[model samples]
Target: MKHLAERARQVIPGGVNSGQRSIPGLTDLVITHAAGARFRDSQGREFVDYHAAFGPPLLGHNDPDVSAAVAEAGRTVDLCGVGVTAGEVELAETLAELVPSVEKVLLTSTGSEATFHALRVARAATGRRLVVKFQGCYHGWHDAVSLNVISAPEKVGTHDPISTGILPEVLQATLVLPFNDAEAVRRAFAEHGDDIAAVILEPVPHNVGCLLPEQEFLETLRAECTRAGSVLIFDEVITGFRHHLGGWQAISGITPDLTTMGKAIANGYPVGALGGRADLMELFSSRPGGPAFFAGTYNGQPAVVAAALATLRKLREEPVHEHVFRLGERIRTGLAEVFASLDIPALVTGYGSVFVGYFMTGPARTYDDLLRNDANMFIGYRRRLLEHGVFELPLNLKRSHVSYAHTDADADHLLEAAASAASLARGDVLDLTDASTMGGADAHR
Candidate 1:
């Protein structure tokens, strides 16, 4: 809270570039280094990390294998023209083999760019103008995806948020619908079927602390999109490798026409991809007779490409789903126990390795339901947890992704922190033993 904030505030807007980073948690220590499950902050405080860099870092920070792969790739043939690279071409094939829906892959720098290009492809392929997206689910800061992202619940009732700094007309071609309600999706199609190009969404909405939809609802969405001739795009950037090797779409038996993925594809390295039915993906692939050309200088940098290949190969070998599922269950149960003690009605949402904690009694099925949950409780817990040497993504609404690095022991420590913080939140602020176990104990003063 000393030189970190003062120095950062002098240079960076809002004291940080990303909105989540500036959140006041435990003296707002800036991290200097991280390994497996632990990170050492600039203030020299050590903490168990669960934020995982906004759903990346699935293999944990600075994985030696991934780091080594990147270094070797860089030292070998660092620069490749936008034309082609054997490394990227092989990585694309690997993606196709892993994600059945993707017959070909178009590389991109981040989830937003992938979605942007995917939307353009969908429009060209379908010959339509409007697009549909679920409310509260984030697809990055790009115009189409950012509309109606969030409005803090009390301000609006299931409408586009505008989010400030965005041109109002930018959202004119976009339609925001309530998530997990098949009726709403159906109604959109019924009204604007002919004009729609794509219905894009995160197959698992981890953006809002992991708001999962009804299975039937997801099925119905796929069905409606098909009937309306609109492309169905699954933004599986977070859930692809984290949920399962293929993703939630595979588990739910829903196939999207276009799918975008990032985050865990290269562990912590920056990499992203968009792919689906070859016919649709070809819209972006340059053609002799067609008008689409997707190319970038750093689209498939060799280092990141190598990292993705190595990370995916490891996942293929170990198959981490089973153990992560168990860990997720234990964490949910443990957190439930904490909330129970505090006389608060709460539960964790999403698949194993991803979770959203809610403080409401109602089941959070839609964006609105998730929006109504306890923000104050989350902020309170976040402050206490960080002070106790646990790092989170700051705000209550963001999804927290777990990684292979977090053990059952780490889960136990987290549960203890949640329980202690819940007490603080309820105004009881009970004195607990072993406060020193969580670093930054001086933060409370």
Candidate 2:
């Protein structure tokens, strides 16, 4: 792994293609191939694959159905000059049928594109400039929604850009606030009701360790957005197909005006979709000079659409959600027990097949609660888990995912690995509550 990382650094900007893979105290593996719930590193070591391609491999790596579908498309479909294939139309129909808030669909090639277009549509439809996004909620890498996904502990409500390239006007247009803070949402709406184009969030925030949305918090956003005439966009890229067939909107019973979906929607394919009320989505149409512009060369590319249709159909027809939910429950229970028995001050937060273990004392309700966990200890624990052949991302402040391919045996192995890792992590003595040692809980629940 180290050798490959070194080689990658010689060509790639920072050894890895993405910044998340370049975390300290870890060597990112160069994977050869993956199947079911395990993948082999370049050195031929197979690890139980809990990373799940950062959430897209919900049905597991190279699922036979998905692979076959892609193969069929490769044989029968064209990559260029196809001009609206049946696969794209079918995939759009499937999305409209399955996702609860989707009355219409506009396909994109990536999650970032989906989010970028959604924001544009919101701004165009409402004739407003400002957008409301909560702290710790990752929409994508676009300049409009780039700030505050993972900022410093002191920068929670400051609308600070996570990256250096974002413009000052972009930061000013975004109203960053704490998650689960209803009063803050109300206050923001009250103050900028006229200027706020949309209020966007991850209904079930997983980027910062599967922070579930409080019912009141979601309801508050819905009510305030309606009152303020602002579009409510749910960035369900990660939670889309992972949580339910209809995404988080189905579970929460509070639908957003626009929903951006990707990642798990296609079960590891490069695809993204923006869907919402027909009126809002129509803003993208060029007919009669529709205000918002959305264009992409690879929008609804045939092979990806084929994989997505197969994945979504399998998710809809089979008992996939039930099986994964059972595994998630077992993990949550087992981790709590492991931490209690080990006498480790920790909190496990998640819903469905997504979870993360934070070295903390109590429940985590917001991004600030998440920031209080000991990063160094968590990093060590993650490294120990990797040593035990459990393949979760080596980052501390991120979520780990389980997939449909993970069996009962895989869950048991994960529990065992976690227990061993927790024990190995005990030697690093650090205060879990001290803000200086651990990032302080900056916001009250």
Candidate 3:
């Protein structure tokens, strides 16, 4: 595993394509194979996979039904970008039926592309230049909506770029505000309501450990956007089908004007979709004078569309949501019990299949609240758990997820590993001969 990563680094910029995959100590072990709830690393070490490929393995890795559908579609389908296929039509119809806000759908190749196009459509429809996005709610890595996610609390309203190479004008056009805070929304819209093209957010902001929106907060945003004639967009790349069969907007009962979906929607396939109101979406139509421009060579590749169709069908047939939610609840309760028994100052947060362990005493309500967590300690604990064959994301501040394949036995194994990891984090050292001195160290440890 070490040799493979070292060789990969010679060619790949960071030994990994994505920054989050570059775990400090564990990046050496490249995954060789995955199936069901567990996967094997290049070193032939097997671990229960809680990362679930960052929340896309809804039915677990290498699901036979999904794989079979993709295989069949690939064999029969011709080259992409030729024209529309039956699979594309079927998948589009499925999306429109599932997502309450989707009257029409435009397929893309990734979540970032979906969001980029959604913003373009919104700006064109409203004839506005400014966009409003909440802090800690990651839409994607696109330049327009990428600012302010994972920024320091002190930098909440700064509208600074989280990455390099972003245009200064892009920063000026976007207004970054606090999540779950209605007053922030009111203030931004009050000052520049007519100039705001759209207000986008993850209904349940999963980028910061699944921060659920307050009912009144979502309601206020919806009302404000309606009054201001700004588009309301829900970036559900992480929460689309994980929370429910439909998007989170359906369960929350606050419909957005546009919604972006990816990740689990295709069950690990490369697919993204921007779906929304018919009138706004029609701007992409080839009416010779249509307003919004939208194009992608691999937008509706048959194999990806087939895989998504099969995955959604399986989700409908099986109790995937109910099962995963039950498992997530079990893991949450078990972790709380383990932390209490170990006397660790920690909290298990999130809803449905998503959760995170914040090394803090209280619930995490906002990005600022998460700042109180001991991030280094949390990463240390995660590394310790990794050593014991439990694989949550080794990166700090990312959410852990459960797939449909995760069972009660897997949950038990994770809790057992976590108990030991927490003990290790506290440096539980014992010295029988020096009992008197042990009390001094005990207080702080």
TM-score of 2: 0.94
Worst 10 residues of 2 by lDDT: 436-445
Candidate 3 lDDT tens digits, 324-396? 9999999998998899898888888779888788888766767788778776667678778888888887555
Better of 1 and 2 by TM-score: 2
Local lDDT at 17 for model 1: 61
- For candidate 2, lDDT tens digit of each residue in 1-445? 3488688878998677655655454455678888999998787788998877678989999999999999999999777844678988888888899888899998888888888899898888888999988888888878888777666677766877756788899889988888999999999988899999999998877777767788999999999999999999998888898998888999999989999999988898889999999998887863456778878888888899999999998998898989998999899889989998988998887888988888898778888887788887786787788888897776656678888999999899889999999898778654434322222111100
> Which regions of candidate 1 deviate over 4 angstroms?
1-5, 25-28, 154-159, 428-445
**Candidate 1 residue-wise lDDT, 138-232, digit = tens:** 77767776765555555444445445677667677888888888898888889999999999998766766767768888898889988988999
Clashing pairs for model 1 are none
User: Which ranges of candidate 3 are over 4 A from the true structure?
Assistant: 285-288, 428-445
Q: In candidate 2, residue 57 scores what lDDT?
A: 87
For all candidates in order, the CA lDDT equals 0.76, 0.83, 0.82
